[model samples]
Target: MISTVLQAVGLFVATNIDDIIVISLFFARGAGQRHLTAKITAGQYFGFAGILAVAVLIALGAGAFLPVEAIPYFGLVPLVLGLRAAWSSWREYRDNDGDDDSDGDSATGKGSGNAVGVLGVAGVTFANGGDNIGVYVPVFVNISHTAIAAYCVVFLILVGALVYIARFVATRRSIAEILEQWESVLFPLVLITLGVVILVSGGAFGL
Candidate 1:
Protein backbone atom coordinates (compact mmCIF):
# COMPACT_ATOMS: atom_id res chain seq x y z
CA MET A 1 0.00 0.00 0.00
CA ILE A 2 2.74 2.40 0.92
CA SER A 3 4.59 1.38 -2.21
CA THR A 4 1.55 1.94 -4.34
CA VAL A 5 1.01 5.36 -2.77
CA LEU A 6 4.61 6.26 -3.39
CA GLN A 7 4.34 5.19 -6.99
CA ALA A 8 1.28 7.34 -7.40
CA VAL A 9 3.00 10.37 -5.93
CA GLY A 10 6.10 9.81 -8.05
CA LEU A 11 4.09 9.33 -11.20
CA PHE A 12 2.12 12.49 -10.62
CA VAL A 13 5.23 14.54 -10.03
CA ALA A 14 7.09 13.12 -12.99
CA THR A 15 4.20 13.85 -15.29
CA ASN A 16 3.23 17.24 -13.88
CA ILE A 17 6.45 19.11 -13.19
CA ASP A 18 6.42 20.66 -16.66
CA ASP A 19 2.95 22.01 -16.08
CA ILE A 20 4.19 24.01 -13.09
CA ILE A 21 5.89 26.58 -15.28
CA VAL A 22 2.80 27.09 -17.42
CA ILE A 23 0.42 27.12 -14.49
CA SER A 24 2.59 29.48 -12.49
CA LEU A 25 2.82 31.88 -15.39
CA PHE A 26 -0.95 31.92 -15.66
CA PHE A 27 -1.27 32.73 -11.98
CA ALA A 28 1.34 35.44 -12.29
CA ARG A 29 -0.43 37.10 -15.20
CA GLY A 30 -3.73 37.34 -13.38
CA ALA A 31 -2.44 38.05 -9.90
CA GLY A 32 -4.64 41.06 -9.45
CA GLN A 33 -7.85 39.43 -10.55
CA ARG A 34 -9.25 37.17 -7.85
CA HIS A 35 -12.04 35.99 -10.09
CA LEU A 36 -9.75 35.08 -12.93
CA THR A 37 -7.49 33.26 -10.54
CA ALA A 38 -10.36 31.04 -9.46
CA LYS A 39 -11.23 30.30 -13.05
CA ILE A 40 -7.66 29.35 -13.94
CA THR A 41 -7.45 27.14 -10.91
CA ALA A 42 -10.59 25.33 -11.93
CA GLY A 43 -9.26 25.09 -15.43
CA GLN A 44 -6.17 23.33 -14.18
CA TYR A 45 -8.31 20.83 -12.31
CA PHE A 46 -10.55 20.25 -15.28
CA GLY A 47 -7.60 19.83 -17.60
CA PHE A 48 -5.89 17.30 -15.36
CA ALA A 49 -9.15 15.47 -14.87
CA GLY A 50 -9.45 15.11 -18.60
CA ILE A 51 -5.94 13.67 -18.83
CA LEU A 52 -6.70 11.12 -16.13
CA ALA A 53 -9.93 10.20 -17.82
CA VAL A 54 -8.13 9.48 -21.05
CA ALA A 55 -5.50 7.42 -19.31
CA VAL A 56 -8.22 5.39 -17.65
CA LEU A 57 -9.93 4.71 -20.93
CA ILE A 58 -6.75 3.64 -22.65
CA ALA A 59 -5.63 1.55 -19.70
CA LEU A 60 -8.92 -0.27 -19.63
CA GLY A 61 -8.43 -1.00 -23.29
CA ALA A 62 -4.97 -2.43 -22.44
CA GLY A 63 -3.12 -0.14 -24.77
CA ALA A 64 -0.05 1.99 -24.57
CA PHE A 65 0.10 5.78 -24.12
CA LEU A 66 -0.82 6.42 -27.76
CA PRO A 67 0.18 5.55 -31.23
CA VAL A 68 3.80 6.58 -31.74
CA GLU A 69 3.22 8.99 -34.57
CA ALA A 70 0.22 10.51 -32.89
CA ILE A 71 2.30 11.61 -29.91
CA PRO A 72 3.61 14.55 -31.89
CA TYR A 73 0.10 15.81 -32.53
CA PHE A 74 -0.29 16.67 -28.88
CA GLY A 75 2.62 19.05 -29.33
CA LEU A 76 0.55 21.14 -31.68
CA VAL A 77 -1.81 22.18 -28.93
CA PRO A 78 0.89 24.10 -27.03
CA LEU A 79 2.42 25.30 -30.25
CA VAL A 80 -0.83 26.92 -31.28
CA LEU A 81 -1.41 28.29 -27.80
CA GLY A 82 2.03 29.83 -27.69
CA LEU A 83 1.55 31.38 -31.10
CA ARG A 84 -1.80 32.75 -30.01
CA ALA A 85 -0.23 34.24 -26.91
CA ALA A 86 2.59 35.82 -28.87
CA TRP A 87 0.13 37.35 -31.31
CA SER A 88 -2.01 38.73 -28.52
CA SER A 89 0.96 40.28 -26.76
CA TRP A 90 2.22 41.83 -29.95
CA ARG A 91 -1.17 43.34 -30.66
CA GLU A 92 -1.50 44.68 -27.13
CA TYR A 93 1.88 46.37 -27.31
CA ARG A 94 1.08 47.90 -30.67
CA ASP A 95 -2.34 49.16 -29.60
CA ASN A 96 -1.27 50.52 -26.24
CA ASP A 97 2.13 51.94 -27.18
CA GLY A 98 3.75 49.27 -24.95
CA ASP A 99 3.23 51.34 -21.82
CA ASP A 100 -0.21 50.28 -20.67
CA ASP A 101 0.51 47.61 -18.11
CA SER A 102 -1.16 49.25 -15.16
CA ASP A 103 -3.78 46.54 -15.34
CA GLY A 104 -1.54 43.44 -15.19
CA ASP A 105 0.84 43.26 -18.14
CA SER A 106 -1.61 42.70 -20.94
CA ALA A 107 1.29 43.11 -23.29
CA THR A 108 2.82 40.19 -21.54
CA GLY A 109 0.24 37.39 -21.21
CA LYS A 110 -2.72 38.61 -19.21
CA GLY A 111 -5.09 39.16 -22.09
CA SER A 112 -4.29 35.81 -23.65
CA GLY A 113 -5.27 34.08 -20.45
CA ASN A 114 -8.39 36.17 -20.16
CA ALA A 115 -9.44 35.78 -23.75
CA VAL A 116 -8.79 32.05 -23.77
CA GLY A 117 -10.34 31.84 -20.33
CA VAL A 118 -10.69 28.52 -18.57
CA LEU A 119 -11.05 26.45 -21.71
CA GLY A 120 -7.82 27.58 -23.29
CA VAL A 121 -5.79 26.94 -20.20
CA ALA A 122 -7.55 23.62 -19.87
CA GLY A 123 -6.65 22.83 -23.42
CA VAL A 124 -3.02 23.59 -22.81
CA THR A 125 -3.06 21.39 -19.76
CA PHE A 126 -4.70 18.55 -21.63
CA ALA A 127 -2.47 18.76 -24.65
CA ASN A 128 0.62 19.18 -22.56
CA GLY A 129 -0.42 15.97 -20.86
CA GLY A 130 1.10 13.46 -23.24
CA ASP A 131 3.63 12.45 -20.62
CA ASN A 132 0.92 12.10 -18.04
CA ILE A 133 -0.94 9.61 -20.15
CA GLY A 134 2.26 7.79 -20.87
CA VAL A 135 3.21 7.42 -17.25
CA TYR A 136 -0.26 6.81 -15.88
CA VAL A 137 -1.26 3.89 -18.08
CA PRO A 138 1.07 1.29 -16.62
CA VAL A 139 0.02 1.94 -13.06
CA PHE A 140 -3.62 2.25 -13.84
CA VAL A 141 -3.43 -1.05 -15.65
CA ASN A 142 -1.91 -2.97 -12.79
CA ILE A 143 -3.87 -1.44 -9.94
CA SER A 144 -7.30 -2.23 -8.67
CA HIS A 145 -9.97 0.41 -8.97
CA THR A 146 -9.87 1.04 -5.23
CA ALA A 147 -6.15 1.67 -5.42
CA ILE A 148 -6.73 3.82 -8.42
CA ALA A 149 -9.14 5.89 -6.38
CA ALA A 150 -6.53 6.37 -3.71
CA TYR A 151 -3.96 7.33 -6.29
CA CYS A 152 -6.39 9.81 -7.75
CA VAL A 153 -6.99 11.35 -4.38
CA VAL A 154 -3.30 11.69 -3.68
CA PHE A 155 -2.58 13.10 -7.10
CA LEU A 156 -5.38 15.68 -6.78
CA ILE A 157 -4.40 16.76 -3.30
CA LEU A 158 -0.85 17.26 -4.48
CA VAL A 159 -2.11 19.25 -7.42
CA GLY A 160 -3.90 21.64 -5.11
CA ALA A 161 -0.78 21.94 -3.04
CA LEU A 162 1.23 22.65 -6.14
CA VAL A 163 -1.18 25.37 -7.14
CA TYR A 164 -0.95 26.95 -3.74
CA ILE A 165 2.83 26.99 -3.95
CA ALA A 166 2.95 28.34 -7.47
CA ARG A 167 0.34 30.98 -6.72
CA PHE A 168 2.27 32.05 -3.69
CA VAL A 169 5.36 32.35 -5.83
CA ALA A 170 3.43 34.51 -8.26
CA THR A 171 2.47 36.92 -5.48
CA ARG A 172 6.01 37.68 -4.50
CA ARG A 173 6.93 41.26 -5.29
CA SER A 174 10.37 40.37 -6.65
CA ILE A 175 9.09 37.63 -8.90
CA ALA A 176 6.16 39.78 -9.98
CA GLU A 177 8.49 42.60 -10.94
CA ILE A 178 10.68 40.31 -13.00
CA LEU A 179 7.70 38.65 -14.62
CA GLU A 180 6.29 41.99 -15.68
CA GLN A 181 9.51 42.78 -17.44
CA TRP A 182 10.38 39.37 -18.89
CA GLU A 183 7.31 37.14 -19.00
CA SER A 184 6.14 38.90 -22.14
CA VAL A 185 9.11 37.36 -23.86
CA LEU A 186 9.87 34.32 -21.75
CA PHE A 187 6.42 32.84 -21.22
CA PRO A 188 5.58 32.29 -24.86
CA LEU A 189 9.08 31.12 -25.55
CA VAL A 190 8.77 28.50 -22.86
CA LEU A 191 5.53 27.22 -24.31
CA ILE A 192 7.03 27.14 -27.75
CA THR A 193 10.11 25.32 -26.52
CA LEU A 194 7.90 22.83 -24.72
CA GLY A 195 6.02 22.18 -27.92
CA VAL A 196 9.13 21.80 -30.00
CA VAL A 197 10.65 19.39 -27.54
CA ILE A 198 7.52 17.33 -27.52
CA LEU A 199 7.47 17.29 -31.28
CA VAL A 200 11.08 16.38 -31.76
CA SER A 201 11.09 13.84 -29.00
CA GLY A 202 8.04 12.19 -30.50
CA GLY A 203 9.80 12.02 -33.86
CA ALA A 204 7.41 14.36 -35.54
CA PHE A 205 8.26 15.32 -39.14
CA GLY A 206 10.98 12.65 -39.03
CA LEU A 207 12.98 14.83 -36.67
Candidate 2:
Protein backbone atom coordinates (compact mmCIF):
# COMPACT_ATOMS: atom_id res chain seq x y z
CA MET A 1 0.00 0.00 0.00
CA ILE A 2 2.75 2.39 0.95
CA SER A 3 4.75 1.64 -2.13
CA THR A 4 1.74 2.08 -4.36
CA VAL A 5 0.93 5.39 -2.72
CA LEU A 6 4.47 6.62 -3.16
CA GLN A 7 4.53 5.57 -6.79
CA ALA A 8 1.28 7.30 -7.52
CA VAL A 9 2.47 10.49 -5.86
CA GLY A 10 5.71 10.48 -7.80
CA LEU A 11 3.98 9.76 -11.10
CA PHE A 12 1.46 12.49 -10.53
CA VAL A 13 4.14 15.11 -9.98
CA ALA A 14 6.36 13.95 -12.81
CA THR A 15 3.59 13.70 -15.38
CA ASN A 16 2.08 17.08 -14.63
CA ILE A 17 5.03 19.40 -14.21
CA ASP A 18 5.26 20.53 -17.84
CA ASP A 19 1.54 20.96 -17.98
CA ILE A 20 1.60 23.14 -14.92
CA ILE A 21 4.31 25.28 -16.47
CA VAL A 22 2.48 25.77 -19.77
CA ILE A 23 -0.80 26.48 -18.05
CA SER A 24 0.95 29.02 -15.87
CA LEU A 25 2.24 30.69 -19.01
CA PHE A 26 -1.25 31.10 -20.30
CA PHE A 27 -2.27 32.50 -16.98
CA ALA A 28 0.59 34.94 -17.22
CA ARG A 29 -0.92 36.05 -20.54
CA GLY A 30 -4.12 37.00 -18.77
CA ALA A 31 -5.81 33.72 -19.59
CA GLY A 32 -5.64 33.63 -15.81
CA GLN A 33 -8.98 35.32 -15.38
CA ARG A 34 -11.54 33.26 -13.47
CA HIS A 35 -13.94 32.66 -16.35
CA LEU A 36 -11.39 31.76 -19.00
CA THR A 37 -9.32 29.73 -16.59
CA ALA A 38 -12.41 27.76 -15.64
CA LYS A 39 -13.25 27.22 -19.29
CA ILE A 40 -9.78 25.99 -20.07
CA THR A 41 -9.85 23.82 -17.01
CA ALA A 42 -13.16 22.38 -18.06
CA GLY A 43 -11.92 21.66 -21.56
CA GLN A 44 -8.82 19.97 -20.18
CA TYR A 45 -10.77 17.90 -17.69
CA PHE A 46 -13.16 16.75 -20.37
CA GLY A 47 -10.36 16.00 -22.78
CA PHE A 48 -8.41 14.15 -20.13
CA ALA A 49 -11.44 12.20 -19.06
CA GLY A 50 -12.16 11.25 -22.64
CA ILE A 51 -8.62 10.17 -23.33
CA LEU A 52 -8.34 8.22 -20.07
CA ALA A 53 -11.61 6.49 -20.76
CA VAL A 54 -10.41 5.47 -24.18
CA ALA A 55 -7.20 4.18 -22.68
CA VAL A 56 -9.16 2.19 -20.14
CA LEU A 57 -11.34 0.74 -22.82
CA ILE A 58 -8.36 -0.18 -24.91
CA ALA A 59 -6.70 -1.84 -21.96
CA LEU A 60 -9.73 -3.90 -21.14
CA GLY A 61 -10.67 -4.80 -24.68
CA ALA A 62 -7.15 -5.66 -25.61
CA GLY A 63 -6.73 -7.70 -22.49
CA ALA A 64 -9.20 -10.19 -23.88
CA PHE A 65 -7.55 -10.28 -27.31
CA LEU A 66 -3.87 -9.42 -27.18
CA PRO A 67 -0.70 -10.22 -25.30
CA VAL A 68 0.19 -8.09 -22.29
CA GLU A 69 3.78 -7.69 -23.43
CA ALA A 70 2.75 -4.94 -25.83
CA ILE A 71 1.62 -2.77 -22.96
CA PRO A 72 4.94 -1.33 -21.90
CA TYR A 73 5.67 -0.09 -25.40
CA PHE A 74 2.61 2.06 -25.00
CA GLY A 75 4.99 4.37 -23.17
CA LEU A 76 6.19 5.53 -26.56
CA VAL A 77 3.26 7.89 -26.92
CA PRO A 78 4.56 10.12 -24.17
CA LEU A 79 8.11 9.71 -25.41
CA VAL A 80 7.19 11.48 -28.63
CA LEU A 81 5.05 14.06 -26.93
CA GLY A 82 7.78 14.78 -24.38
CA LEU A 83 10.26 15.42 -27.16
CA ARG A 84 7.84 17.85 -28.78
CA ALA A 85 7.26 19.68 -25.51
CA ALA A 86 11.01 19.96 -25.03
CA TRP A 87 11.42 21.36 -28.50
CA SER A 88 8.64 23.84 -27.95
CA SER A 89 10.13 24.94 -24.68
CA TRP A 90 13.58 25.26 -26.18
CA ARG A 91 12.16 27.34 -28.98
CA GLU A 92 10.40 29.53 -26.47
CA TYR A 93 13.73 30.19 -24.79
CA ARG A 94 16.01 30.29 -27.80
CA ASP A 95 14.11 31.91 -30.67
CA ASN A 96 13.12 34.95 -28.61
CA ASP A 97 11.84 36.61 -31.79
CA GLY A 98 9.30 34.01 -32.88
CA ASP A 99 6.46 33.67 -30.39
CA ASP A 100 6.69 36.10 -27.54
CA ASP A 101 5.96 39.79 -28.03
CA SER A 102 7.54 42.89 -26.45
CA ASP A 103 5.77 42.26 -23.16
CA GLY A 104 7.27 38.76 -23.17
CA ASP A 105 3.88 37.26 -23.91
CA SER A 106 3.50 34.40 -26.37
CA ALA A 107 3.21 35.71 -29.93
CA THR A 108 -0.26 34.41 -29.87
CA GLY A 109 -0.57 37.67 -27.83
CA LYS A 110 -1.94 38.42 -24.42
CA GLY A 111 -5.54 39.04 -23.39
CA SER A 112 -7.10 37.64 -26.57
CA GLY A 113 -4.12 35.40 -27.14
CA ASN A 114 -4.22 33.70 -23.78
CA ALA A 115 -7.95 33.30 -23.86
CA VAL A 116 -7.47 29.54 -24.07
CA GLY A 117 -8.98 29.19 -27.50
CA VAL A 118 -10.24 25.65 -28.01
CA LEU A 119 -7.49 24.75 -30.41
CA GLY A 120 -4.65 26.26 -28.43
CA VAL A 121 -5.81 24.93 -25.09
CA ALA A 122 -6.42 21.47 -26.47
CA GLY A 123 -3.10 21.38 -28.22
CA VAL A 124 -1.19 22.44 -25.14
CA THR A 125 -3.07 20.04 -22.91
CA PHE A 126 -2.46 17.15 -25.25
CA ALA A 127 1.23 17.89 -25.47
CA ASN A 128 1.62 18.32 -21.74
CA GLY A 129 -0.37 15.15 -21.04
CA GLY A 130 2.15 12.97 -22.82
CA ASP A 131 3.88 12.09 -19.60
CA ASN A 132 0.65 11.31 -17.83
CA ILE A 133 -0.40 8.81 -20.48
CA GLY A 134 3.01 7.20 -20.45
CA VAL A 135 2.92 6.81 -16.70
CA TYR A 136 -0.59 5.46 -16.84
CA VAL A 137 0.27 2.80 -19.42
CA PRO A 138 2.70 1.12 -17.05
CA VAL A 139 0.84 1.79 -13.83
CA PHE A 140 -2.39 0.50 -15.25
CA VAL A 141 -0.84 -2.91 -15.48
CA ASN A 142 -0.84 -3.13 -11.71
CA ILE A 143 -3.82 -1.06 -10.63
CA SER A 144 -7.51 -1.83 -10.90
CA HIS A 145 -9.88 -0.04 -13.29
CA THR A 146 -11.58 1.67 -10.40
CA ALA A 147 -8.26 2.96 -9.18
CA ILE A 148 -7.48 4.39 -12.60
CA ALA A 149 -10.77 6.21 -12.69
CA ALA A 150 -10.23 7.52 -9.21
CA TYR A 151 -6.76 8.73 -10.09
CA CYS A 152 -8.06 10.56 -13.15
CA VAL A 153 -10.69 12.29 -11.06
CA VAL A 154 -8.13 13.35 -8.52
CA PHE A 155 -5.78 14.57 -11.21
CA LEU A 156 -8.44 16.74 -12.81
CA ILE A 157 -9.32 18.26 -9.48
CA LEU A 158 -5.71 19.07 -8.72
CA VAL A 159 -5.21 20.57 -12.17
CA GLY A 160 -8.23 22.79 -11.72
CA ALA A 161 -6.96 23.97 -8.36
CA LEU A 162 -3.54 24.73 -9.78
CA VAL A 163 -5.04 26.73 -12.65
CA TYR A 164 -7.03 28.77 -10.17
CA ILE A 165 -3.97 29.48 -8.07
CA ALA A 166 -1.79 30.35 -11.06
CA ARG A 167 -4.45 32.66 -12.45
CA PHE A 168 -4.69 34.46 -9.14
CA VAL A 169 -0.96 34.86 -8.98
CA ALA A 170 -0.75 36.05 -12.57
CA THR A 171 -3.33 38.68 -11.78
CA ARG A 172 -1.26 40.11 -8.99
CA ARG A 173 0.77 43.17 -9.99
CA SER A 174 3.90 41.98 -8.23
CA ILE A 175 3.77 38.36 -9.36
CA ALA A 176 3.05 39.20 -12.99
CA GLU A 177 5.93 41.64 -12.95
CA ILE A 178 8.23 39.00 -11.52
CA LEU A 179 7.21 36.44 -14.10
CA GLU A 180 7.74 38.90 -16.92
CA GLN A 181 11.17 39.84 -15.63
CA TRP A 182 12.55 36.32 -16.02
CA GLU A 183 10.46 34.90 -18.81
CA SER A 184 13.14 33.59 -21.11
CA VAL A 185 15.40 31.96 -18.55
CA LEU A 186 12.73 30.40 -16.43
CA PHE A 187 10.60 28.89 -19.25
CA PRO A 188 13.51 27.23 -20.95
CA LEU A 189 14.93 25.73 -17.80
CA VAL A 190 11.64 24.43 -16.57
CA LEU A 191 10.65 22.97 -19.94
CA ILE A 192 14.05 21.44 -20.59
CA THR A 193 13.98 19.71 -17.23
CA LEU A 194 10.46 18.48 -17.75
CA GLY A 195 11.26 17.29 -21.26
CA VAL A 196 14.35 15.37 -20.18
CA VAL A 197 12.56 13.77 -17.27
CA ILE A 198 9.66 12.61 -19.42
CA LEU A 199 11.91 11.39 -22.20
CA VAL A 200 14.13 9.44 -19.84
CA SER A 201 11.19 7.76 -18.20
CA GLY A 202 9.55 7.06 -21.54
CA GLY A 203 12.77 5.39 -22.72
CA ALA A 204 13.13 7.86 -25.56
CA PHE A 205 16.86 8.62 -25.04
CA GLY A 206 17.66 4.87 -24.89
CA LEU A 207 18.15 5.32 -21.16
Candidate 3:
Protein backbone atom coordinates (compact mmCIF):
# COMPACT_ATOMS: atom_id res chain seq x y z
CA MET A 1 0.00 0.00 0.00
CA ILE A 2 2.82 2.36 0.84
CA SER A 3 4.58 1.44 -2.38
CA THR A 4 1.38 1.99 -4.31
CA VAL A 5 0.96 5.44 -2.80
CA LEU A 6 4.56 6.30 -3.61
CA GLN A 7 4.14 5.07 -7.15
CA ALA A 8 1.01 7.17 -7.50
CA VAL A 9 2.83 10.26 -6.36
CA GLY A 10 5.71 9.66 -8.73
CA LEU A 11 3.39 9.08 -11.65
CA PHE A 12 1.41 12.19 -10.84
CA VAL A 13 4.52 14.34 -10.66
CA ALA A 14 6.06 13.03 -13.87
CA THR A 15 2.87 13.26 -15.86
CA ASN A 16 1.78 16.68 -14.65
CA ILE A 17 5.00 18.65 -14.29
CA ASP A 18 4.41 20.43 -17.56
CA ASP A 19 0.97 21.44 -16.38
CA ILE A 20 2.49 23.70 -13.79
CA ILE A 21 3.81 25.86 -16.56
CA VAL A 22 0.45 26.02 -18.24
CA ILE A 23 -1.41 26.74 -15.04
CA SER A 24 1.05 29.38 -14.03
CA LEU A 25 0.64 31.07 -17.35
CA PHE A 26 -3.09 31.16 -16.84
CA PHE A 27 -2.74 32.59 -13.36
CA ALA A 28 -0.16 35.13 -14.37
CA ARG A 29 -2.79 37.23 -16.12
CA GLY A 30 -3.25 39.12 -12.83
CA ALA A 31 -6.10 39.70 -10.37
CA GLY A 32 -8.66 40.34 -13.07
CA GLN A 33 -8.36 36.68 -14.04
CA ARG A 34 -8.97 35.27 -10.57
CA HIS A 35 -12.35 33.85 -11.45
CA LEU A 36 -10.89 31.88 -14.33
CA THR A 37 -8.61 30.06 -11.92
CA ALA A 38 -11.45 27.89 -10.65
CA LYS A 39 -12.55 27.23 -14.19
CA ILE A 40 -9.05 26.22 -15.18
CA THR A 41 -8.77 23.94 -12.17
CA ALA A 42 -12.06 22.30 -12.99
CA GLY A 43 -10.99 21.91 -16.59
CA GLN A 44 -7.72 20.31 -15.63
CA TYR A 45 -9.48 17.78 -13.46
CA PHE A 46 -12.18 17.07 -16.00
CA GLY A 47 -9.68 16.65 -18.82
CA PHE A 48 -7.40 14.48 -16.73
CA ALA A 49 -10.30 12.32 -15.69
CA GLY A 50 -11.22 11.82 -19.31
CA ILE A 51 -7.66 10.81 -20.15
CA LEU A 52 -7.59 8.36 -17.24
CA ALA A 53 -10.87 6.80 -18.30
CA VAL A 54 -9.59 6.16 -21.78
CA ALA A 55 -6.31 4.79 -20.52
CA VAL A 56 -8.07 2.53 -18.05
CA LEU A 57 -10.28 1.04 -20.71
CA ILE A 58 -7.35 0.49 -23.04
CA ALA A 59 -5.24 -0.96 -20.27
CA LEU A 60 -7.94 -3.43 -19.28
CA GLY A 61 -8.41 -4.50 -22.85
CA ALA A 62 -4.68 -4.90 -23.41
CA GLY A 63 -4.24 -6.73 -20.13
CA ALA A 64 -6.77 -9.32 -21.19
CA PHE A 65 -4.77 -10.09 -24.33
CA LEU A 66 -1.14 -9.43 -23.49
CA PRO A 67 1.07 -11.60 -21.37
CA VAL A 68 1.94 -10.22 -17.96
CA GLU A 69 5.66 -10.09 -18.69
CA ALA A 70 5.18 -8.16 -21.89
CA ILE A 71 3.37 -5.35 -20.13
CA PRO A 72 6.53 -3.39 -19.52
CA TYR A 73 7.23 -2.92 -23.20
CA PHE A 74 4.46 -0.38 -23.13
CA GLY A 75 7.12 1.80 -21.59
CA LEU A 76 8.26 2.35 -25.14
CA VAL A 77 5.27 4.66 -25.56
CA PRO A 78 6.71 7.27 -23.20
CA LEU A 79 10.24 6.63 -24.47
CA VAL A 80 9.19 7.49 -27.98
CA LEU A 81 7.19 10.45 -26.74
CA GLY A 82 10.25 11.76 -24.93
CA LEU A 83 12.45 11.38 -27.97
CA ARG A 84 9.92 13.16 -30.16
CA ALA A 85 9.62 15.99 -27.64
CA ALA A 86 13.37 16.36 -27.58
CA TRP A 87 13.47 16.43 -31.36
CA SER A 88 10.74 19.04 -31.51
CA SER A 89 12.50 21.21 -28.97
CA TRP A 90 15.72 20.96 -30.88
CA ARG A 91 14.01 21.90 -34.10
CA GLU A 92 12.35 24.88 -32.45
CA TYR A 93 15.62 26.03 -30.96
CA ARG A 94 17.41 25.76 -34.26
CA ASP A 95 14.64 27.43 -36.19
CA ASN A 96 14.55 30.32 -33.77
CA ASP A 97 18.31 30.62 -33.53
CA GLY A 98 18.14 29.70 -29.81
CA ASP A 99 15.60 32.37 -29.00
CA ASP A 100 13.32 30.63 -26.50
CA ASP A 101 11.20 33.77 -26.36
CA SER A 102 9.55 32.93 -29.67
CA ASP A 103 8.53 29.53 -28.43
CA GLY A 104 7.11 31.04 -25.24
CA ASP A 105 5.21 33.61 -27.20
CA SER A 106 3.78 30.95 -29.46
CA ALA A 107 2.58 28.87 -26.52
CA THR A 108 1.05 31.85 -24.72
CA GLY A 109 -0.58 33.09 -27.88
CA LYS A 110 -2.26 29.76 -28.53
CA GLY A 111 -3.77 29.52 -25.06
CA SER A 112 -4.43 33.15 -24.38
CA GLY A 113 -7.89 34.67 -23.81
CA ASN A 114 -9.15 31.96 -26.13
CA ALA A 115 -8.97 29.45 -23.29
CA VAL A 116 -10.84 31.38 -20.63
CA GLY A 117 -13.81 29.08 -20.70
CA VAL A 118 -13.96 25.75 -18.89
CA LEU A 119 -14.23 23.71 -22.05
CA GLY A 120 -11.40 25.60 -23.66
CA VAL A 121 -9.14 24.94 -20.70
CA ALA A 122 -10.26 21.32 -20.64
CA GLY A 123 -9.41 20.99 -24.29
CA VAL A 124 -5.97 22.44 -23.72
CA THR A 125 -5.35 20.18 -20.75
CA PHE A 126 -6.44 17.11 -22.65
CA ALA A 127 -4.31 18.06 -25.63
CA ASN A 128 -1.27 18.68 -23.47
CA GLY A 129 -1.82 15.35 -21.73
CA GLY A 130 -1.58 13.21 -24.83
CA ASP A 131 1.72 11.71 -23.68
CA ASN A 132 0.13 11.03 -20.31
CA ILE A 133 -1.94 8.25 -21.84
CA GLY A 134 1.21 6.48 -22.93
CA VAL A 135 2.70 6.57 -19.46
CA TYR A 136 -0.54 5.72 -17.71
CA VAL A 137 -1.74 2.74 -19.74
CA PRO A 138 1.08 0.42 -18.79
CA VAL A 139 0.95 1.44 -15.17
CA PHE A 140 -2.76 0.87 -15.06
CA VAL A 141 -2.47 -2.47 -16.82
CA ASN A 142 -0.25 -3.89 -14.13
CA ILE A 143 -2.28 -2.69 -11.19
CA SER A 144 -5.57 -4.03 -9.85
CA HIS A 145 -8.77 -2.05 -10.41
CA THR A 146 -8.94 -1.20 -6.72
CA ALA A 147 -5.43 0.11 -6.80
CA ILE A 148 -6.25 2.13 -9.84
CA ALA A 149 -9.20 3.65 -8.00
CA ALA A 150 -6.98 4.59 -5.10
CA TYR A 151 -4.48 6.13 -7.45
CA CYS A 152 -7.23 8.13 -9.06
CA VAL A 153 -8.25 9.48 -5.66
CA VAL A 154 -4.70 10.48 -4.96
CA PHE A 155 -4.42 12.07 -8.36
CA LEU A 156 -7.56 14.14 -7.89
CA ILE A 157 -6.27 15.53 -4.63
CA LEU A 158 -2.91 16.24 -6.13
CA VAL A 159 -4.47 18.02 -9.05
CA GLY A 160 -6.00 20.53 -6.69
CA ALA A 161 -2.69 20.90 -4.93
CA LEU A 162 -0.96 21.41 -8.24
CA VAL A 163 -3.33 24.22 -9.13
CA TYR A 164 -2.63 25.93 -5.86
CA ILE A 165 1.10 25.52 -6.34
CA ALA A 166 0.87 26.95 -9.82
CA ARG A 167 -1.10 29.89 -8.53
CA PHE A 168 1.55 30.52 -5.93
CA VAL A 169 4.34 30.27 -8.45
CA ALA A 170 2.58 32.69 -10.75
CA THR A 171 3.22 35.36 -8.17
CA ARG A 172 6.87 34.45 -7.92
CA ARG A 173 8.50 35.93 -10.94
CA SER A 174 11.96 34.45 -10.40
CA ILE A 175 10.79 30.87 -9.97
CA ALA A 176 8.31 31.13 -12.80
CA GLU A 177 11.00 32.49 -15.07
CA ILE A 178 13.32 29.65 -14.17
CA LEU A 179 10.66 27.03 -14.74
CA GLU A 180 9.71 28.56 -18.08
CA GLN A 181 13.32 28.74 -19.16
CA TRP A 182 14.09 25.13 -18.35
CA GLU A 183 10.74 23.42 -18.92
CA SER A 184 11.41 22.30 -22.49
CA VAL A 185 14.61 20.53 -21.57
CA LEU A 186 13.40 19.33 -18.21
CA PHE A 187 10.12 17.88 -19.37
CA PRO A 188 11.66 15.59 -21.97
CA LEU A 189 14.32 14.42 -19.60
CA VAL A 190 11.74 13.62 -16.96
CA LEU A 191 9.68 11.65 -19.47
CA ILE A 192 12.73 9.70 -20.62
CA THR A 193 13.66 8.89 -17.05
CA LEU A 194 10.10 7.84 -16.26
CA GLY A 195 10.08 5.46 -19.23
CA VAL A 196 13.29 3.87 -18.04
CA VAL A 197 11.86 3.52 -14.54
CA ILE A 198 8.74 1.85 -15.85
CA LEU A 199 10.77 -0.55 -17.95
CA VAL A 200 13.10 -1.51 -15.16
CA SER A 201 10.44 -1.68 -12.49
CA GLY A 202 8.16 -3.71 -14.71
CA GLY A 203 11.08 -6.03 -15.35
CA ALA A 204 10.83 -5.54 -19.10
CA PHE A 205 14.51 -6.34 -19.61
CA GLY A 206 14.61 -8.71 -16.65
CA LEU A 207 16.59 -6.19 -14.67
Best by TM-score: 1
Residue 1, model 2: lDDT of 49
lDDT of 2 by residue, 104-181 (tens): 345433323224454445544554455455457666767887677666666666666666766676667887787665
Kindly give the stretch of ten consecutive residues in candidate 2 with the minimal lDDT sum: 107-116
For candidate 1, the per-residue lDDT at 54 reads 79
Ranking by TM-score: 1, 3, 2
* Estimated TM-score for each candidate: 0.84, 0.56, 0.58
Q: Model 2, residue 58: what's the lDDT? A: 53
- Give per-residue CA lDDT, model 1, range 5-73, as digits (tens): 898888788778767778778775565565766777778888888777777778788345555347567
Which model, 2 or 3, shows the larger lDDT? 3
Candidate 3 lDDT: 0.68
Clashes of each: 0, 1, 0
The sequence of per-residue lDDT tens digits that candidate 3 reaches over residues 1-207 is 888888999999998987786677555432344477788788788878876776777787844544445556656655655575577666666666755467554443222322245664565565455467778888888989999988888888899999898889876879757655665675457556756766777777777
lDDT of each: 0.74, 0.55, 0.68
